[model samples]
Target: MTLYETIFVRRSVRKYDKTPLDDETLRGIQKILDEAERIDGQTGRFEIVVGSRVKNATAPHYIFAFSEANDGAYANVGYVLQKVDLYLQSIGVGSVWLGAGKPVESAPDYVIMLAFGKTEVPLRSGAQDFRRLVLGEISDGDNAVAQAARLAPSAANSQPWKLHFEDGKVTVRYFGRGLLKAMLKKMNKVDIGIVLRHIEIALLKEGKTVRSVTATAAAGGGDLTAEITYVD
Candidate 1:
């Protein structure tokens, strides 16, 4: 299936089966990780780490991902990781973002962990519905983006983003109020990128195209913006 198709079918999978990852699936994931690293480059500033755990240790099997904590970067990490997660799902691998209870740890200044594996539990009932938001009913243009932005995951799903729209551009502001505010700012960038990804996906599904995404801090006090222009 295509990447967008994967995006549509992918859901957060929390429970796992006892089955182990096959050689082919492992190779495919490795290849994608390599390509993602190259595409992300130094400008994007993120990394994906894959590891395995003993059965019953936590999840039967998993892949852990992290990136250096820098301003406006976590959002990008989320964006990139979402794509990686989608690709994994396309191959019949189950995955979910590991939250507070998982045994994952962070380095001194790093954003850590996305759990991937095969699940025994049936897919969650409302998982697909969770991705939906009302675009037509959004009165504040920026909030429309923010509504979508809220869906973008952050460290522990903290969601520390605020958006404002002006003229033809959308501005994304970082609130930086969480405990790890500095780390959150970097993660927020990847989150912004994830938000951008959702905005483009939603628009394309509606037969619209985004013209551009430019970053600006017009809202002041560390607020970051992504000005999106629509295609006529």
Candidate 2:
């Protein structure tokens, strides 16, 4: 299935077979990580290592993301890695986002990691398999984009984002939640990026071409926002 179709069936796979992937498969995944797009004005780095290099070995491989600490950077990491997550599953590999995971030799800029390997788990049947907020709660309208984007995973399922659609673009704003404001703020930023990818794919599936994607900080340091413009 294409990445767009994979989104509906994908799930966070925690139990993976311990066998390492072939060198060719690992290299192909590395290439995907290297070429994945980022949120504008953000610079993030990625690395693929064996499970032995990570603190928990749920999977045989882990892709670690590193970037400067900030909303845009964190969001960029999510935007890029979510593509890898979808692609891995599209090709029969299983993956899951690891927020609490750490590398044995950590970089100061590390943001998050994705654990992936072969698995026995099955993909979800379709959109019905996802347990998420209704479209009205997360977006302004029940368009196809909102439907697909709502399924994007968040830290602890916080889903802290609000989407505003306009003539030629959609603006994603960070909507903070939970008692731990400090921690949720960071993960929610990543969630914003993940949803952005879903929005882009949904738009493309609707026969729209993305013109540009830009990220910016709200005035007075309020919401962190990313705007995506497209042409029909």
Candidate 3:
């Protein structure tokens, strides 16, 4: 299925069948990750670990993402891994983002992970299945682009982002501040990257492209992690 189609059907499935996928299917998922984009532009690693090696979850396979510690590293990890998550679902495999577990040892800078296998759980049957903020609630554009951003997931489901459109450009800002900023800045950057992916997919469906996806400091006496400019 196309990424656009898969977006509506994907689910964060935690319970998966213990049966390992055949080599062919595994190879397909590997191919998807191999060609996936890493938006954070830093040193990173992806690995395939068997269920026996993973601690918290029981699944036939786990895909791991590791990156050198840096500003926005976690968000970059999310940006890259979200594509893999969608592709697995496109091909009928289950996946969920795991923030709690880690490699037993000898693993360093392990930023994030994805757990995948077969499952009986259904992806969203319709758009109504998504429990996301309305367009007016999170963004100024109130268009397809904003809708895509609205559905992007965040750590603890925080959904901490704001979208601005001006002069045909789209600027995303980290909206929560003060105690919220103190709490979720790094995590919000990661969530912004995930929203960026969603924006790209939605734009592509609409025959648009994102140009010069850049991270810029916010104007209000603090740092805003990242933003994207749109181009036809």
Candidate 4:
């Protein structure tokens, strides 16, 4: 299926069949990851691992995607990981960003995990049924991805992100206020990543491919930024 088709067809699949990713499918996943890393250079700042165990016991049959902390440096791990999630969906795989779970001891800095497998039952809803808002529909141009991003789940639904669009690039700014910042900083970029995932899904639906996506540290009072540049 085309990227847009996958976006429209994809859903947050939780339950999975016993089937694991075949070698061919795993190679395909690697290709997608490679492309995502190429498009977004932040891939080098972290690592991606695969495992059968779900960090949370309640959700077994899950695959893992983890990232190491870079001394709390440019915290765009979430943005990068979310790109991984959307790319997986585009290639006929299902994944859910696993936010709440037991941290792997070997990888304490690893912020997020993704559950993966074949769906036992298809999701009933279509992508069109999924929310995608237009520029004019929003209260401010700076909130380009607000509605769609809001749909992105955060730890306990804190929704700690503010987005801005300028120079044809969508900039995701973190709202690092309240008690949630210090507590959720480890996984905060993960939420931005999920929002970036939603934006990419919307762009693909519009028949455009994201040429590049980048995350940078907040300077002069800005939080992390996720910039999406489109293909012609």
By lDDT, who's the top model here? 2
Tens-digit lDDT track for model 2 on 151-171?
A: 898888888888999988999
How many pairs collide in each candidate, listed in order? 24, 0, 2, 4
Every candidate's lDDT: 0.53, 0.88, 0.74, 0.57
Please write out the lDDT profile of model 1 over residues 76-162, one tens digit for every residue.
Answer: 555556666767777777777653423344445445456676775443343255544343322246333444444544554555555
The runs of at least 3 residues in candidate 2 whose Cα sits more than 4 Å from the true structure, single-residue gaps closed, are none
lDDT, candidate 4, residue 204? Answer: 61
For candidate 3, the per-residue lDDT at 164 reads 83
Sliding window of 10 residues with minimal summed lDDT for model 4 = 135-144
lDDT (Cα, tens digit) per residue for candidate 4, span 76-162 = 455555565666666656677666755444454455566666665464255345544443432146332444554564655566666
TM-score order of candidates, top first: 2, 3, 4, 1
Candidate order by decreasing lDDT: 2, 3, 4, 1
Count backbone clashes in candidate 1.
Answer: 24
Better of 2 and 4 by TM-score: 2
Q: Looking at model 2, which ten-residue stretch has the lowest summed lDDT? A: 177-186
- Model 4 accuracy (lDDT, Cα): 0.57
TM-score of each: 0.62, 0.96, 0.88, 0.68
- In candidate 2, how many Å is residue 36 off? 1.2
